[model samples]
Target: MNATAKLDEYIPVVGQAIIDDLKLLAERLAQKHVLHVNSTAVGGGVAEILSRMVPLLGEMGINTKWEVIKGGDQFYQVTKKFHNVLHGRPDEVTPADFEIFMETSRKNIAEMNTDYDIVFIHDPQPIALIQKKGQNKWIWRCHIDVSKPHPIVWAFLKEFIVRYDASVFSAPSFSQQLPIRQALISPSIDPLSEKNRELSPEDVDRVLAKYQISRDKPIITQISRFDRLKDPVGVIEAFLMVRKYIDCQLILAGGTATDDPEGLQVLAEVKEKAADNPDIHILLLPQNDFEVNALQRGSDVIMQKSLKEGFGLTVSEALWKVKPVVAGNVGGIPLQIKHKYSGMLCNSVEGAAFALKQILNSPAFAKRLGENGREHIRNNFLLTRHLRDYMLLFLSLDYAEDLVYL
Candidate 1:
C-alpha cells in the first residue's frame, strides 16, 4: 500500500472505532490550514511524530504543512544550552547566546510566511517565531520537562510563550503556570510505523547479527540520542552493577540530531567510560525505523535512564513492543509506567540495577510486566489518540466562549 493509504491498516490495531472518531473530527477541521513549525525535520520525537502526523492529517483532508527553521551551529549550541537549562540543568546562557538566537529568529521571520488558520510551534528552537503571528491562532507545543526550569532561561522564554493563543504540554507535571490556556496532550507512537512495528523472527535476528550481538546471552539495550541528559554514563554504571550479578550484554544505540551539537562530545564520553568493555556495545545508529524496531524486538530488557525528559518516547516505544523497561523516575516516565505494575522506575544507578536484576531473574514476571505495558500503550499512547486530542484542541479554540465565570 501507499504511505498514506497504509494509515488505514492502523484501524485493526487501534480499533475501527478510533478510525471512525478521527474521521469525524477531521470533518470538523476540513480544509482548515494548519502549519507546523519546528527546528529540524528529522531526529528526536517531535520530528518523528510530525513526520507521521502531518501526512495523516493530509490523508484526513486537512490543509496541513510542516516547516523547519534555519540556523547555524552557534544557534543550535545556544538552543542546546537552553534545552539543558530548561530541564533544570545548570548552563550558562550569556548575552551572546541571546543575540545568536534572536539573529536567527530574525532571519526566519524575514524568510518565512505564516498566514494560516492555526500555526503550531514545536519546542524552544522555533518558539520565537510567534513574533510573526498575525490574525491566526498560535499554539506553542512544549515537548520538555519545564516544571523546574532555570530561572533566567524560563523568564526569558516566557516572554514569547505568553503570546500564543494556547500551549500544549505532554504531561501535567511538565506544565507551567502560564497566562494562556493550556492543554495536557501526551505524545504518541505509530504502531504501524517501522520504528514500533512488529518484525519477523528472521528480521530481528538479522539486525542482531548485523551488530554482532549474540542471542546466547540475554541482551539489554537502551536506545536514545547520546546526550548527557539521557545519562548514558549512568546507564553504563547501572549495567556494570547488574553485570556483577548477571550474564548479559549491553547495547547503547542512538543517533545524533541536527539541532544537538553536543551529541558527538557526549558520545565520546560514553565510549571513554565504556573503555573496551566487549560486552558493552555502543552503536551509533542511523535514523532507520526498521532497525530500531528490530533492536527493541531482539532485546531482553530495555532501559531509559534519562535525568530529565519530556515524555521519553523511547519508554513508550519499548512498552509498545511489550519489553519490560527500567526507566528513570523523572519527567513523563511516571505517566507511562505504574512502578512495579507495568514497568520498573529507578531513581539511581543502584535502583536501576535492582530493577534490572528483578526483571532479568524472573522471566514470568518480566513477561507479565511487558504484557501490561503493551496494553497501556495501546490504551493511551498511540498516534490515533494524539491526533484526536490535537484536533479537539484546534476545534476548542474556535468556541464562542473563551471564559465562563461562575
Candidate 2:
C-alpha cells in the first residue's frame, strides 16, 4: 500500500555495504517478472514476508506480484491435515482428502495466470500449479519442517515437488532429499515493519492495559498462530511449572490463518487447559503487527515452545527487540539462539520452566543475553539479508549450469 521502502532506509541498521550489494544484484535481474503464489494473503508468515518483499522487489527494478490461491472449506480442511502430517504428526489422510486437494488445485490452475519470468509456489497448497508451468522458471518454497514427514503424505507431495526447477527451505535440517536443487534461505523480520519497529513506553503500556493484562509481575509472552505444532498447551504447562518458583504471568496471544482449519480447535484446547489459572491469559488477537510489537516489547521474557517449527520467526522477532527468549531447541530455533548465549533453548516443559525462572531471577544474565541476541539478529536475520538472498537466488536460476558466486 505504501511506496516500496527504499534500501537506503536499512543502511543505518544493516550498513551501507549490504544495501550496495543488493542494488548490484537487483540490477542483474532488472525488469524480470517474479510472481509469488501462496494459499493466504493475510495470516501466515509466507504472506507476511511477501507483503513487504514484493514491493521492495519492484523497487529493485524487478517486476513482482503476489497472488493467493482459492480454496473451499473442505479443501482447506484437507490441507490442514496435510500440514499436520508434514510436521510429523499422525494424521490419517484418506484418498478422499487427496481428491479434494487435486480438485481444488485444478480449479486454481485453470483460473490463475502463469506468465512470469520466475514463479514461486509456496508450500504444498499450491505446489501442483507447476502442472501449468510453461517456459517460465518455477521455484517451490517449502516453509514447513519436512525432514521427518509422514511417509504417506511426503510420498504424495513428492510427486508434485520434484517437478519444480528448484526448492527453497528455511533451514538445512528442514530440507528433504528432493531430486531438485535446494536452497537454505531462512525467514527474516523487517526491522522497519510495524511488528518489529521501535515503540514508545507509552504505547507499550497502552497496549498492555487495553488487553487488561496487569504488570504487577513479570510477563512471559508467546506470539504465534494457535497451531498444534506451536505447542500452546505445552507453553501453558511450562508456565505452570515456572509459577512454583516465580510469580509471573503467561500470555498466549495469536490469531488464526484462513487455510488452517484446526486453529480454533487448538485455541479451545488451550483455553480448557488454562481454565483454572487466572494468571494464564489466552488472548485470541487479530493479525495486528503493532499489538504484537508492543506485547513483545512489554514482556520481561519471551517463549516459543514449538514441538515442531519451520524457522520459528517469532524467536528472531523477540530477539530483535533485545528480549531474552526461552525457545524449543528444535527446527531452526537453534540457528537463531546459541543456548545460554543469545538465549536459552529447551527440549521439554521442565527445561523451559528452568530457563524462565533463571532469566526472571537474574536480571543481569537476562540483560546480557538480550543484548547478544539483538546483535545476532542485526547481523544475520534482518529483512535486508533476506532480500539479498532472494535477489541472488533469482539471478542464480539463469546460470543453472555454471558455478555462480553470490
Candidate 3:
C-alpha cells in the first residue's frame, strides 16, 4: 500500500459507493478512540490484515491505535500450545502453561495503560487483559478455529472470553455458545498490499530466477507457515501423487510467526519429508510480501490444504489473483470455494491429488474457475467489505441488548 493511501484511492478497486459508505460510518463514530491489542506486529494473517486496517481506520477520521504485547520465549510456547488445543488437538496444556500465561499477562496489565473508549483484543494472547476493563467496551476477536477445542483448554480460555462485551468469530461454526454477544466477521486480504497487488511479467520472472525455481514444467504452490495444521506434509504427498502422471514442480514457501514457537520444528519436519526431491522447492522466505505475490502470480495452481484453519486468507489472496485453488474442505475454505464452481475442495490426500490432476489436464476449465473465483473474492472477501463490517460492529457496540450479529 502507498504511504499516503486514502480510502478514496480504493474507489478504483472497490468502486465509489463502498468508500462513501465507510466515510458515512466514520462520521457516526466521530471522536471515538479505538485501540487494538494483539501479540505480534508482524507475520500471520492477524498482523497482515491489521497492517492495512489500522491506517484505513485513521483515514476514516477515527482515533485508532494498534499495540502489541511483550512476551518471552516461554510465554509464546504456552500460547502456541493453547492455539493447538483450541484447534481440537489433544490436551497437552500443563498446569505450568497457565502460570506462564498469567505471569506474563500480569506484567502486561501493569505496564500497559489500556484506557480508551474501546479496547479490541485479538485471539487468546491478550485475552486476559480484559481484567483491566473499566466501563469501556471490549471486543475479543478469535482468529482461530475453536469449533471443537479440547474441553479443558476451552474451559480455561472461556473464563476470560466471557468478560468481553462481544466476541467475533471468523465462521459461524467457530462460535461457541458464549454468554456475551457474538459477531461473525471473516478475515480478508488487502488488494493493494505487496502480497496481493498486481506484478509485471518481468517482476515475476526476476523473483523466480532469484530463487533458482525453474518453471520448465507447470508449478503448483502452497504458501503458508510451516505449521502442522496447514498440512504441508500432506501437500507434498499429494504433489508426489500428481507428479506420477502430470509433470509439475511444487513450491512450499512461508515465513515463521513471532507468536508461533512450533514454526521451526514444523519446518524441519517438512524438510525431512521433502527429502532430496529436486522438483520440490522449499523457500524459507522472510517477511517479504512482494516476492510472495510474484510467486503466487507465477504459479499455475495455488493450494491451501490446511487440516485446521481459522479462515484461510491465502485462499482469498489466490482467488483474487485469478488463480485456480485446490484447498482442504475444512474450516473456512468452503466459504471461499464452491466445489466445482470457483475452485476445488478436497477432504484427503487422494482427493487433493485428483483435484490437482483435473486442473492440470483441463486448461479451459481452470480459466473459468479462476474467473469465477476472482469475482467471488471481489464481491465478498475484499478489504472494503471487511472494513464496512468492522465499522458496523463498532456501531453495534453502542446498543445494550444483543446487537453484535453484524
Candidate 4:
C-alpha cells in the first residue's frame, strides 16, 4: 500500500473524520522537508516513535527524514549522565562531561546535513545541532521529564535549547519557564506496530514457552529498558509483595540501548534484587516486538511502575491491548491514566502492590479499567493523534495565527 493508504489502515481504529482532518493538514505541509535527529537508531521511545512516524509522514506527502548523530562511547556516557541529571537523578557530572558532549556534537555538526524546512531534534544528545541552523525553522522535542533538572546541567543545555524556534514537551508539568514558545505534545505508540499489535492465543503461548513462562499463574509483566528511572527493581519488590498472597509470576523483560551505558549495571541490580527466585523471570529481551506483544497480550495485568517518566509508552501499549495497568503517578503517565478509571496509578512500591492485588482480586474492576483505558488511548495516545499534533506544530510556523497555544 501507498503511505497515505497504509495510514488508512488506522481509519478503523481512529475514525474517518480524524484521517480526513489529517489529510487536510497534510495538504498544508505537502512535501515540506522535515529532518529528525537523535542519538541512536535503535532502542528508546524517541527512536520507536520516529520509526513509524517518519515513514507515515512520508506517505502523507511530507518529505520526512530521520538522522542519527554519530558519537563514540565517551560521548554517550556523558549524554546518559545528562539524561539522569535532567530527570533529577543524582549524578556526578564534571566539566569533562560537557567537553566530551560538545566534542562529539562538533563532529556531528560538521558531518550532518541540517538543511530542511523544519529541523526537529529529539532530546539532549542532539540539542547542540542547533549550531548548524540556517534560516530553517528549528524545533527541539524533549522526550524526558525535566521538571526538576539540576541547575548546572539545565543551564548548559538551555544555551542550545533557547536557540530553537520552539520546544515541545511530553507533558505540561515537564515544561520549564523558557523564553521560546512551547508546545505540549505527548509521545505515542503505533497500535499497528508489533509491540502493540494483537497476538493470537497460540502465538502468546509460544512466546511464553520460549521464555519458559507458564500460564498456570497470573503474569505481571513490565516491558522497559533496565533503567533505574523505570524502577524494574521496585517492580520486583512489588511483585514479591503480591506473590506473598497471590500465585503470580513476575517478568522483567528489556534490553539496553546503544546510547545508554548504565543498562547492564541496572540489569545487574535487578538480578540481585530478584535473588534467584524462580517465580521471577528476568529476561534481558532484545528488540523483539513480537515477544513483547505476546507477553503483554498473555498477561493478566501489566505494570509500568516508573519512578520518573517522560510519557510511559509502555502504559499506553498495555492499555491499548485492553489490559489493566498499574503505573506511577509521575510525569506523562498521569496524562495516559485517569487513576481508577482508565488504569490504576500508584505512588510507592506499597501502593503498586496494593493496586496489583486490587486488579487481581476483582475481575470486574480490572475489566472496567482495561475497557476505559483502551478508549482513552484510542482518543489520545495513538500514532494518528501524534501525527495530527506534529503536522499542526509544523504548519504553525506558516499560519502563526492558527496555533495560539504555541
Candidate 5:
C-alpha cells in the first residue's frame, strides 16, 4: 500500500471523531509556525519523534520546522553527565560543567533563528534556548524521568526551564512541580515507519545475516543506544544468568547519538564484559531503521534492561512487533508493560534474568504475552494517539482553564 493509503487505514482505527478533533485543531493552528529544537538530528527517541511529527504537523496545515543545535565534544560530555544525574545517578556535575553548558548555549543563542509562533525545546540539551526566548510561546519538553534528579543538576536546569510558557513530559511521574503549567504527553512510534512496519521472514533473516547473528538458537534481543543509563552491561549480565537455564543467544544492538559522548565508552565496556561468551552477540548497528525492525521481528524474545530511561521507545517497538518483552520497571516502562499481563517488568538483574528464563522456557506463556503486548501498544503507544495528544496540547496552551476533551 502507498503511504497515503496506509495512513488512511489508521483513520478507521483512530475513528472519525479523532479526525474531526484534528481538523478543529488544524484550523486553530493554521499558518502558525511551530519549531522544534533539540540536540541531535539522528538517534535517540526525541529525534525519532520529531522526524515523523514535524512532517505530519505540516501535512495538517501547520507550518512546522525542526532545528538541531550544534555542540562540541566537551559540551556533550557535560550534558551526558547531566543526563545521568537527572536519571538519579550519582554523577558529580561540577559548577564548571554548568559554565560549559552556558557557554555552548550562548553560542547557539546567537546563531539560531527563533522566529516562530510556538517554540518547542526538547530535553535539557537545548533547554537553554529558552534563555533567548523571543516573542514566541516557548514550551520545554522534558523526556527524562526527573522524579529523583540530582539536586545540583536539577537546580541548574530548573532555572531555565521555569522561563518557558509550558512544559511537557512523557509520564506524569516524570513531571516536576514547575511554576509553569505542565502537560503529560508520552512519546510514540510511527506504525508506518521502517522501524515498526511489518517485515517478511526473508527480510528478517537478511538483517540477521548482515549482522552475523545466528538464527539457530532462540534470539533474545535488546535494541538501545550504547549508553551507561541503558545498562548494556547489565543486559549482558542478565543474559548470562538466563543462558545457564535456557540455551538462547543474546543480541545487544545499538547505535551512537551525536549528543551522547559516552556511547563509545559504554559500547567498549559491553564488548569487554561479553568477550568470553560467543553467543552474546554485540551488534553495533548504524542509524538503520529497517534493520532495527527486522532484528526485533527475528528475535524470539526482546529485552529492555535500562537502569534509567526517558521512555524506552525500544520497548514499544518490540511490543508493536508482537514479541514478548522483559523490561526494567523504571521510568515510563511500567506505563508500557502491564506486569505479566502484557509484558514482564523487572526491577533487578536477577529479576530480569528470571523473567527472561520464563519467556524462553514456556512458549505458550510467551506467545500470550506477545499477543497482549501488541494490543497494549495498539491502544496506547501508537503515533496517531500521540499526534492527537500533542495537537490537543497545542490547543490547550491557548485554553488552559477548561479541559479540552477529544
Candidate 6:
C-alpha cells in the first residue's frame, strides 16, 4: 500500500486530532534528519516497525533513513548470547564474546554513515553504533527487557549506552534507572500489513490448505520465532495439556531472523520435544506475513507462551486479528492483554493450557474476548499510535523544558 493511503485509514480510528498533531510535529521537525540503525532489515519486530515507520516519517516531511550494521557469524552468535543474557538468562558471556562484539562494532563504526539529526539505535546488535555518535541526538531504542540483565553483559554494554542522549523502552518495568532520560514507547503492529489486514475466508482457507493444516479440529497456534525466550517448547507442553480435554491441534510457526543464530538450534529442540505428535505442527515459515495472518485467523485459539518477551509483536498481531490470545503474564504481554477482558494471561504451561481449554470450550466467550482484544489494540497498539508517540518523543527531545505543553 502507498504511504498516503495507508495513513488515511487511521483517520476513522485515531481521528483528525492525531493527524493534525502529527502534521504540527512534522512541521516542527521538518529540518530534522532521523536515522534508524538496527541489525537486520527484516525478520525481527524492529525491522517491521521501521519498514512502516520510516516511510511515514519521510512522508511527513522528515528526512528519515534506515541502516543495518553488518556482522559475521561469530558476531551474531555473541549478540544472540547477549540477547539471552539481557532477558535475564544466565548465559556465560565470555571475554571473547565482548572482544568479537567490539571488533565488529569497530568495523561498522569505520564504515557507517552517522550523519543524521537524530540517530535511533535499535537493540543490542547495532547498539555499539552509538560509540561513533558525533554531534547528534542519539537515542538508543532497546526493544528488549533488561530489567534483570546479567551484570557483566549489562556493564559491558553500559559503556556505549550511557553516551546516548535518551533511551526508549517498551514498558516501564523493562526500563533501568540510568542517568540518561528514558522514554516509554510501546511497539506496535501495522493493521494494514499483510499480517493484520482483513482477510477473506477463501484466503484464510487457501493458506491453511497450502500448509496442510486441517480445519476439522480446533487449532491452537503460537506464531513467534523459534527462540527459547518465546518458549516454543513450553507452548508444546501447554498444547499437550489442552489436548487432554479438547481434541485440538497445535501449530507453532515462525521464521528466523538474520541476527538470531540460535533459531535453528531452538527449532530442532522444539521438533525433538514434539516428536511423533502428528497433531502438533512445527512450521518454519519463510517470513511470509500473509501466511501468518491466515494461520492466526484460521485458529480457534492463539497463544504467546513467552517466558521473556520484548512486547511480543505476535500477540499484538493476533489481537489485531480479533483472536482470543492466551499469552504469558510476563513482560509486555500483560500490557497487551487485560485478563478476562481482552484476553487471558498465563504464568505457566499449566495456566496457558487451562486458558486455552477455556477459550476452546466456550466459543461465545472467546469471540467476546477477541472483539475486546482487537479494540484494545486498535486504540493503543496500532502503528499510528506508535508513530504519534515517536513524533512526540522527537519533539520532546527538542523542547526538553516545556515538552508536555500539549
- Extract clashing residue pairs from model 2: none
lDDT of 2 by residue, 272-330 (tens): 99986889988888768899999999999999998888888899999999999999988
For residue 318, give model 6's deviation from the true position in Å: 0.7
Clashing pairs in 5: none
Q: Flag regions of model 5 displaced more than 4 Å.
A: 1-20, 69-81, 88-100, 103-115, 131-136, 210-217, 226-228, 255-278
lDDT of 4 by residue, 59-102 (tens): 88999999999999999889888887887878898999999999
Off by more than 4 A, model 6: 1-6, 12-17, 70-74, 94-96, 110-113, 129-135, 255-279, 401-403
TM-score for each predicted model, relative to the true structure: 0.88, 0.88, 0.89, 0.88, 0.84, 0.87
Worst 10 residues of 6 by lDDT: 1-10
lDDT (10s digit) by residue, model 6, range 1-406? 3334456676776678877878887888889989988999876678867888998888899999999999999999999999878877777888899999999999999999998889989988888888777878889888988888889999988888899998899988888879888988999987777777788999999999998888999998998888887899999998888888889999999887666679888988999999979999988898687798899999988988888777777888888888999998888888999999999998988898889888998999999999999889988898888988888778777666743665
Residue 110 C-alpha lDDT in model 3: 94
Record all residue pairs in model 3 with backbone atoms less than 3 Å apart, i.e. clashing: none
> In every candidate, how many clashes are there?
0, 0, 0, 0, 0, 0
lDDT of 5 by residue, 66-181 (tens): 99999999999999999877877777777899899999999999999998988889999999888778777898888888988898888888889889999998877787778998
lDDT of 6 at 81: 95
In model 2, where is the ten-residue run with the lowest total lDDT? 1-10
Encode model 3's per-residue lDDT on 207-241: one tens digit a residue. Answer: 99999998799999999989887999999999999
